[model samples]
Target: MTTVTTRTVTYQADALTMVGHLALPAGSDRRPAVLIGPEGVGLSDVERRRAEALAELGYVALAFDLHGGRYLSDPEEMLARCMPLLADPDRMRGIGHAALDVLRAEPRADLDRVAAIGYGTGGAIALELGRDGVNLRAIGTVNGLTTGRPGEAARIRCPVWAGVGSEDPIMPPAQRQAFTAELQAAGVDWRLAVYGGALHAFHHPPVDHTALPGVGYHPRHAQRAWRDIVGLLAECLPVAE
Candidate 1:
């Protein structure tokens, strides 16, 4: 196993103090960087481990926070906080940019070679960054096919890859069609993968707390989605050994 180091970082956004986790590979040479966003439930061990995994793969990674470092275990609270934030693209951009700044601040981060990947609400933020014309090598989202203003999507220069469960009630076929149509109209390079028999948040591991309906964990699909995400990163933002 490759040696990696991680630390807790705190930054401010939207008048709230956000705590994020940063992970780096063993060496000092600058490497491509990846920004990870957590699901609507907020940043937890899942995202932190992802950052660590990316670091092991030789990319500087940061798992950014949502809800100001608070994890929403309550379904009502998660929806109440995420629904409004998701509805406001500007707000999502604010969160994404703030985390990007943190990632860029790292000495080993190659600003010119960066990618943004998110799950759930975090995924929406990644898409928003692309819409905001952020120069990303690639963008990956899981169960986060939320649509944005078409005009803004035209500004996205990087390739986008999204994955969702076929049975996801939150992002059903119609919603998926609308999202792809927006991307197609904008002429953005994009791809979508639907995992059969998987539900929303399938990438996430089983949780002890209660979750809303239509959300569950699928270990097998989760592994497959991670491989796809890594493949996208490798294709778009290869890290030299």
Candidate 2:
């Protein structure tokens, strides 16, 4: 892996001070950037490691935060915060844009060559950014197959890739169907990969806290999804050789 640097970046979104993890490649050249969003439980070392991993691959990565820098391990507490946040697209867009601004402001970031990738609630924010027409090079999400408002998917200008678990009750077959239908009708280039026998949040590593129902980790699928995301970035926003 290439040398990389890591830091904490504080920003405001949804009336909360978000403390995001920023990772930079070991170079002075302008580089493509990626935004990493965490699950509903909020930003943890899990996402921080992902950002550093992307940095090792020579891309600027910002693992944006939710819940003002707190990790809500309590399922009830997380839903209490995320349910309302999810219901308001504007709020989610606000958070996404706020993080995007942070990434773009970094001198090393190539503004035109940026992508958004996230998991769970964070995945939903990534999709929201695409729907908001943010000029992203590509969008990738795991367990974040959230359908957008009618006609909004048409605004997305880049290809979208999503991964889900076949047995995820939270995002069952019907939800996947509806999400794909919206994208298809909008004519957006999109693809979905369902990992058989996997559950929701399959991309996430095992957590120290109790997970919600239908939420569990699948190591094999997690590695596969990461590879697929790397492939997506390679095709759409490859780093300079």
Candidate 3:
């Protein structure tokens, strides 16, 4: 049986109190820490489950809330709250750094082998963190965009893996191609995995109609994505002897 423990950590961002949940493996000793950013809607049960699963894999996982304690089910409202952060990449980077600070404050987390994983808007934040040279061992994204300031490549210090749906309309083929070219030109160690027949938010097993437009949950893709994430983390953050 797998055991997981959850705790609340308080941190300040711009003088405002932000709360996050730290999930830990039952017997994990000095394991790497993973910071999990929720989707536009907020830290839902699904996101918590993802963090718990990571903890079960013997990593300290921190699921931070960028939206305080509020969550909206309506897609419009979710976008209203999330669009500002996406449009202003600098602000998004600040939020990612804030979450990293929270993770570093945890006693069980091994700050040296840190990684950030996100979905959609959250995914963009993960990419931003890596691009900004946050000392991340690795970064992973699920159906996230990669466009941002150009100079970020110089600051990137870790490998990145992005998973996207081949049919994802949000991140169209042309944009993906451009993004890939940019990463290549920047010489960032990165991998892009496109899942055919899968749509946006493929890793989210349940369709959130209120928060997503024309979304369909694919269990197989989600499972595969989960495995890929674990494998990537293992590769990037090898277990300490």
Candidate 4:
């Protein structure tokens, strides 16, 4: 059994109430915590499963919601709601910082080893947290984009691992190449895992991309992404229990 805590906290100065699921190791003290940002559909079963998996792995995982009860049932709807947020460039960063603050406030959380992982929009937020110097040990993103211009990469202060789909239409080859160049120029320690044939939301099980024929799921990529994320987290903050 896991000793996990659940609650809703206000982020962005009460502008948003984010429901968070925190999983802690049994009898563990000051364990590292990951501030997770859910995918476009917000906090769904996939994220919850990931949180529980992390908990089982002996790290405190905090899954925070950005979508607040409303979720998209289709790609069009998802894009309608997510596009503006991604375009803004600063909203995710602000929300990420706020969420990190909330996580740091937890008595059982080890603020020193704090890190972040975001999917899609959430991934961009994690990058922003690192870019803005949130004192993160490491960060990772799944199907996340880098919206800011080239020069902004210089601000990132933590190691980053980005899992991208080889055929993701939104984040195409050119964009990924540009993103990689920016990271290199900034001198940030980073790794890119390019999975073949996986679409944008590879890990989201309920996401059916039949409507968008080009989008399909690759189970291998999904499993590898999880492994890479778990490994990164464990390396940054080990299970001392």
Give the root-mean-square deviation of each candidate in angstroms: 1.0, 0.9, 1.8, 2.3
CA lDDT of 192 in candidate 1?
A: 97
* TM-scores for candidates 1 onward, in order: 0.98, 0.98, 0.93, 0.90
For model 3, the local distance difference test gives: 0.81
lDDT of 4 by residue, 71-156 (tens): 55577887777788787667777777767777888787887887899888888888877777678888899888574655777777
**Which run of 10 residues does model 3 get worst, by summed lDDT?**
207-216
State the TM-score for model 4: 0.90
Error of 2 at 234 (Å): 0.6
Predicted candidate 2 versus true structure: per-residue lDDT over 150-220, tens digit per residue: 99999999999999999999899999999999999999999999999999888888884435888888899
RMSD of 1: 1.0
Better of 1 and 2 by lDDT: 1
Candidate 1 matches the true fold with a TM-score of: 0.98
Give stretches of model 2 more than 4 Å off. Answer: none
Q: Relative to the true structure, how large is the alpha-carbon lDDT of every model?
A: 0.95, 0.94, 0.81, 0.76
Candidate 4: worst-modelled 10 consecutive residues by lDDT: 5-14
Which residue pairs show backbone clashes in model 4?
A: 118-123
Candidate 4: residue 136 lDDT (0-100):
87
Q: What is the lDDT of residue 184 in candidate 1?
A: 93
